[model samples]
Target: MGDVSITVLDGDTLRSLHVSLREDTVSLTGAQVLDLAESEASRSLLGLSLPQHLKSSALRRMNIDGVDDDVDFRRKELSPEEASRKLNEYLSAIADELKDNPLVASNLDGSALRMLLEDEDDFAMIAENLFTDLDTEDKGMISKREIRNAVVNMGVEMGVPPLEEFPLINDILKKHGAEEEGELGQSQFAELLQPILQEVADALAKNHFAVIHNIKIVNGSELKKVLANEKKLNDVIAKIKQEKDNGKSGHKSTEIIKDFLEKNGKELGLPPSEANEAVILLYDAVFADIDSGKGASEEEDEFRKLVTEILEKFAEQLEANPIYCDLDG
Candidate 1:
């Protein structure tokens, strides 16, 4: 209605909210207020905070027509693959929306742009504030100067260094075919940025699958911590896979791995007591993958002996009473 005001009186505090609408004035209790807030019209006009009972009542009212039934049923029926595809489609739409704004397109570059493309929440936040420093007068478009200023503002907000120059923005424009004298429009900027964003999405998707596969192959979660960089994840996975063909396994290798694990175990997602044991288990799996039914190599045998010795040293911490091969059963 014309204006809706919600006033809540607690023991000593009074909270009030005012919203304007074309409907008539109405006085409603807190529950009624919540019910009214559920309607699309009410939400479009203003936000209201209501208690649980009223919120439930309002939700029931909104669904009284059964318009949401089919959508809810479909959501419940969606498979994991279907849900993932739908989410990707939604993310792609949001990424595309970013391209339609020249100031947003120009302001993003370097690590900031990479993160924006990869993180939907971060991208939305930046896009929401796109017009804060730029003027949209040239046929609803931003100029080169505005783009430069926007980039500097974005960089500063992101805590990036050296705001005195706009080299990153200039470089982005040039790469997107913006000439020194030519004009840059939102559409053109978005079109050029689309491919880069797509590449980022693709890389992220590939890395995600690769990480899952590698973790499964190793049958371990210890790698998750040290594999912070996708490139490093790829490298480590490759090395583990090629261990049979090119891997060096021996007392020296065991010593080196043991030292690495002991020093960086916490950072690698392994506890101090089990760090050496995790490396031993991982190497065993890797060696098994490479052996192809063959026996362990002489070097591998030596490494295994060292690992056994190391594990025996930590036997008290492991709490395992099983006898070693050298001990009588």
Candidate 2:
């Protein structure tokens, strides 16, 4: 069998992967391709094994090269502000399109508008995912029927209907699906109509990341206080500083502290739910204090500096073993 060669071009980052079913060549199963797609280095290769037409369509949406289509995907990574700008343009276009729909006209106020205006990065991410999901035909365009179907699907996912009467709501859904000459092209709907934020937020509330944030917020604060007061914890931090000051090599201070706390956090009054929170807070506090010089006693300045160094090493380990770290600062 001929090998499948997938080339991913993300700006200057180019990667090519080849797989074959032939015994003479290196081969990967479908399951392996799916697994590899979840990794960041290979993530852009996700659509490569799809049907040729579908792969072309997906790459066009991402603006990747090699497509015969006119779409360009050579853009640089967006800054948060640039992402916000792109999302806002989409929101404005969608609001214009649905201006005549009573549901959109009357309901596009308050938090819905705030998400579009303020949380643009998050809104844009949701919009991108939604656009991909709604474009069922893989043509990159969303038909009027697709838009209506998306709304209905979101309503079902969110467990709420626009109207109390089920049949009436179905009628409205069908009516909306039949509008404006029956279809909206890729550029028209995919780019313009996907940034509607209220719907995005409602649908995303059940997402795992949001749930993790809520869990961390509730538990991380208590962990911070407990760790701040733990005497043994401070002792290890002080030792880390002393060794660095003496130019001594080979110290595993962060690991010592993390392992100690992982085993003894409950004895220090932290609840079981806050064990991982304690580990995260310890690293966060070290970096935060070092950066801000906050609350460092004259005698403890060296301690803070050493703690910063120790935490820097600890952060590398944390990235490698990020078991419970799901919240953002």
Candidate 3:
């Protein structure tokens, strides 16, 4: 029920309303937003996410299967709390859309979705070329030139449209000592674009472009900073639990989460490979339904409002999850 417009009612009048959707199916228990997945209109919102969005989501859940869940189901299913078990099938289907596009999934970032939304055909062609490298005789490794070709071709997938702004691309190449006119020929180039792509994806995912003044690659030691703030989040959540009316909106509360991994996001049990996953996870938990620019500006302003219901659900998960039962021992 990603970004669904849910209308709750009792009889002839509206009782409450809900609207939450995603570019991909969100992890059921990742945060506290199970209610967002339970709307009457949720299924109607599933078709909008791009295939890349769908694929990465599946891979992520698959990767987190045993560890993320309380019990190991080994790619089968897990014993999540009531919140976690709500919509497993729907989430799995979205993830299945990407099963064949693993390498492409590796290259996914918010930037790609931004490009896709700017122009669909360009994105389609770039995807076509990007995946071509996966099937090549060279053991499924795509060349930087191929990546460049895919990106630039994103300017015109059908070979018919005018190119939009690609300043981000030029900046990416320049940072690598690569020439503006130079073709990206090294795998390092793909590595180089990761942050920019992730930033773009984040912007697209959240619909608010947090300018990438400069890309700070997440290394092996950034998690310390991200988690340092976790205490702040835990404390706030604790306070909220005590009061049950901390009055913080879910989106704002998530902003305060202070990922302990931010500093050493790649180091403290974090993988640079999945550094961007944090942002995606955060946004997925909060908001990832609007792939295009639709209601983005407004969403930003009302991000907390949008997350109100999910936040409440998280509070419930915290109290009801069996992990707590085990911890209580």
Q: Assess each prediction's global lDDT (C-alpha) against the native.
A: 0.35, 0.38, 0.35
What's the lDDT of the predicted structure labeled candidate 2? 0.38
lDDT of 2 at 275: 49
Runs off by more than 4 Å, candidate 2: 1-111, 114-133, 148-175, 178-183, 187-215, 218-254, 259-284, 287-329
lDDT of 2 at 43: 28
Give each model a TM-score. Answer: 0.22, 0.27, 0.19
Best-performing candidate as measured by lDDT: 2
Expressed as tens digits, the lDDT of each residue in 179-297 for candidate 1 is 44444455544444444334433433333211000011121233332344556544443443244345445334443544544554444333443434554654454334332322333
On TM-score, the stronger of 2 and 3 is 2
How are the candidates ranked when ordered by lDDT, highest leading?
Answer: 2, 1, 3
> Any runs in candidate 1 off by more than 4 Å, and if so which?
1-113, 136-138, 163-169, 178-329
Q: Between 1 and 3, whose TM-score is larger?
A: 1
- lDDT of model 1 at residue 79? 44
> For model 3, how does the per-residue alpha-carbon lDDT over 81-122 read when each residue is reduced to its tens digit?
433443443344333332221111011224435544356455
